[model samples]
Target: MSQNQSRVTEFILVGFPGLHREYYGLVSFVLFLVYAITVIANATVFFLFVTNRSLHKPMYYIILNVSVCDFLFSTTTLPKIISRYWFQSGSISFIGCFVQMCFVHYLGSVNSFIFSLMAFDRYCAICHPLRYITVLKSSTVHILSVTAWSIAIIVPLILAIRAYPLPYCASNIINHCYYDHIGITLLACTDRTLYSFPAFTSAMIILLLPLSFIVFSYCAILIAVSKVADSKNCVKSLSTCSTQLIIISLYYVPRCFVYLTSHVGIQFSTDVRVVIIMLYSLGPPMVNPLIYCLRTKDIRECLVKQFCISTGHPKAQVSVVTN
Candidate 1:
């Protein structure tokens, strides 16, 4: 409860130091392109789910959640960065910084939870085919979705509340692309360890716990598939899990490296850090919908129908998402 415990009025976000102002226009364009793709790709899946009743199944519902989270996740961080580059405005109000930090972390946690839930659903569908319907009933899906959203929202709230009263009597400059929890917290005049350790620990728990669950769920799945009577069906089922694994890998593998780089005292240049963050954060959302359309026949068919109608080529089964 010192002077540094007072809330800040605003924080200046210093985007990539290596990215010179001369290249701001280039960076802005790139950020805008990535944001547009992220939004459009996820929005396509969301639109299809909302308008088409055929996609109302349990698996599709999980996908819908993924799309929603992706869209929100991109929204929470990208626009501010875009504005920073486009308009040369990197100053975010204290509350606005908190809002961005909260949503970025919360939506990320929600996505992690949803991925685990999706793994669990797949495990049930493939391993307990007979009980799949009973196990993942509509009501159960609703409860799980609500639980995921609630947990995600609460975890960040606790962290924000803890840091809310911290005095920011020092330079209110965040040396990052956007208003991130650690970046914002680093600006405070208090002992950095006081907030950093807890933030780091909670992040690890949020990340590792669900990841462990996902691995276990998939292990259970592989074992179950190995015991199946028909080899072809077993392969088919494994393929499904493999596709999902690709999505999981795309989302998580970079994070593992980033954590390693930070922990082992490996130095990444400002531009390198920014690029790394953009890849993991924006890459998965941009690619996930395309994965669904290409890897699954049902989703592919649905998208084709939508494409043909929109282009007025009703006879052709086109994959417009690719284009």
Candidate 2:
């Protein structure tokens, strides 16, 4: 390690640069609100999944995985930025920054894999209806979930291991809301491409591999749905997929745009880039629970049942169907 590395003990996170101090409170409040909502909503879903045995099927199992991922992702990224704005504390220890980067990328890769898992679950349910139950038994789902989460850790750990000892002697200012691979690597004194290219490659592989699977799965699903003779059944099948499709779009589209633009030489100002990044990163966590609650009948029914039970109206409880 270079002497400069020792000199830079902490990094300053310049969140949404050039904003006047007057708006700090407003930004902090909004960010805090988002963090609060994301935590509560995701926690509610996790609680429902845990407490209600009826929600233990493969699809809901995948949903449970998603809620857990969303919860972890938000917890990993939000609090520091909220503190940065609220308490005017943007300084993070070098080791803390690297740890944050590792978990941020790790959770993001896990999310990609989980979405692909969800797509695969839907594919099994709709395309292989006969084998769905046998193929995706609870034990099988647990195995797959463990596999996805376990495999997703490798690239991020590798990236962190490689990047952690870099000579970050030049600048200690991260021009983003939170620590991320690229932002932190760019601060290193060495040629950043040495670290960045591998990170980019890993990101693409992590993103596109599952994305390819998701696209193929959904297309096959559409074909299968088309073959169904009954209009009501077809409609029902598509309706069942609607929520995942919306979430998939929300998660992937903006990310693709950001990656594509950066790779192809299309440039965005730091503020614009950061804003876009924050929007895509934070937007999904905030909206995923809302989408599930409004769009998932079982979850809604469970919520209603819980609400009714809490309010001393057990008679008003809605029965949640076990799939």
Candidate 3:
């Protein structure tokens, strides 16, 4: 490639043009608050898992890692978005775009992988309770974590590198908040099929395939739990699985909507785009810790005890994570 045909130096972002004129201040403020809360929430979850022995189990381990990924994933775009939305500068360097895409893809993949693992963990716990510890040993967990992260990083790196090989003489206006393929494709003189192929594959692996696994595994788990003669055990299992199912749906619905709309050639308004992106990126991180606190008795009890100890309440107060 000639010097002019090299990777873009900078691209102008056109984040929600319609929303930009109306309610810019309101949207920016709301996004800022969501970003801040997501960081704090995920960080707290990771910290809790690290400090609390009661939470040092396989399930919490996956949750802690998921929180870490969510924290990184949200940070990849929100800060720049806050700057652009509030300060009227929506430009990102080509290198910056690549880095943004890398981290976003990596963390998203890691989050998906962790979700799959969590499903399997629940399966083992419910179906083969006696062998849970042996099945998810420390060595196996470490290997799985490393493998997930490696694949997430490696695939994105290859795609980003390959995408820069062609010319980029088209308009440098990125029509999205971040380094999404649709925005970048508009900048390419070529067909942009190279970028699309990898992204399509990655999406299938990260979202659809894992979702299939989660749904199937949970279904099996529910069936297995129903086989127990004890009503108390059945109720307990149903409650726990229901919580997981709810969280999975919350995490997935926005993404599925975006993907389906894009595939169906449905054009989203700038305001709609902004709203959907924020919902997809921010909701999971903020909701995860709340889910754990509300769903698990031990975590809630521990928090209550800790609260009582600090506040000198003489007794623990029950608290729930409200929506």
Candidate 4:
């Protein structure tokens, strides 16, 4: 610590610096609604997965992991920002900021890995039907899930550990809504490139590695689907993969654009950048449950059955068949 450098004990989060004061309530309300929807939808999916024995397969297990990650990520980030805008409270302790940063990146990375896992699962199912069952056994799925979560922790922790010791003698006001790696590190009173480059590289690796595998998996899946003589089976295979593809596009495309623009010197306004970040981060969690419910036959049937049972319509029956 330099003698001239003063330690920052807390940080102020500026939700949207350019926005007028009158819209604070509206912004806060919208954020609250997003939070509420994300929580309810993800919780419902998770509950269905837990209670329904029929959903106890490897594919649903992966979906269950994603549901847990989505809700957990939203929970980690949304409350503070909502409070910041709603209550005019934005101060967060320095340690608290770093803690939030850890989880934000941690969950994001976990989701990336989980998506790759989903792609792999789909690839096996579509490309090699004979070995799919043996390859993605219950124990294998458990090990992969645990490994994805465990490995995702390392990069963020290292970034946090590195950034925590930097001298934050400059401004404590973060320009964004929540604690994130670049948002906090840029405030340090030193050369940010040393930290920023590594952070950027790690982020790219976390994103691109899974993305590459997903592409490869899908390409192989497409080739396999082309060989199927039965058009119905081919369409069914494509339909199953389409849902995962929509989700992957939602998760990756915006993120890739953001990272690429930064790398290529194309800059967006702070508000625009923050809004884009919020959209990509919050959008997937909000819609993932809906996507699964509408697309997956088993989950949809289970949800409908549960709804009927809860409504005291035990004799009411529903069945969904997709081809």
Best by lDDT: 4
Put down candidate 3 lDDT per residue, 141-166, tens digits, no spaces: 77787787777777667667776555
Q: In model 2, how large is the Cα lDDT of residue 128?
A: 95
Q: What tens digits encode model 1's per-residue C-alpha lDDT throughout 26-48?
A: 98899899889988888888888
Candidate 4: segments with Cα more than 4 A from true spot: 1-7, 318-323
- The digit string of per-residue lDDT tens for model 2 on 86-185 reads 9999999988998999999999998999999999999999999999989989899899999999999999999999998888888899899989988988
Clashing pairs in 1: 4-167, 5-166, 5-167, 6-167
In terms of lDDT, model 1 sits at 0.85
**What overall lDDT goes with each candidate model?**
0.85, 0.91, 0.75, 0.93
Candidate 3 contains a number of clashing pairs equal to: 0
Worst 10 residues of 1 by lDDT: 314-323
Clashes of 4: 0
Error of 1 at 260 (Å): 3.2
Report residue 228 deviation for candidate 4 (angstroms). Answer: 1.4
Using lDDT as the measure, name the better of candidate 3 and candidate 4.
Answer: 4
Which run of 10 residues does model 3 get worst, by summed lDDT?
314-323
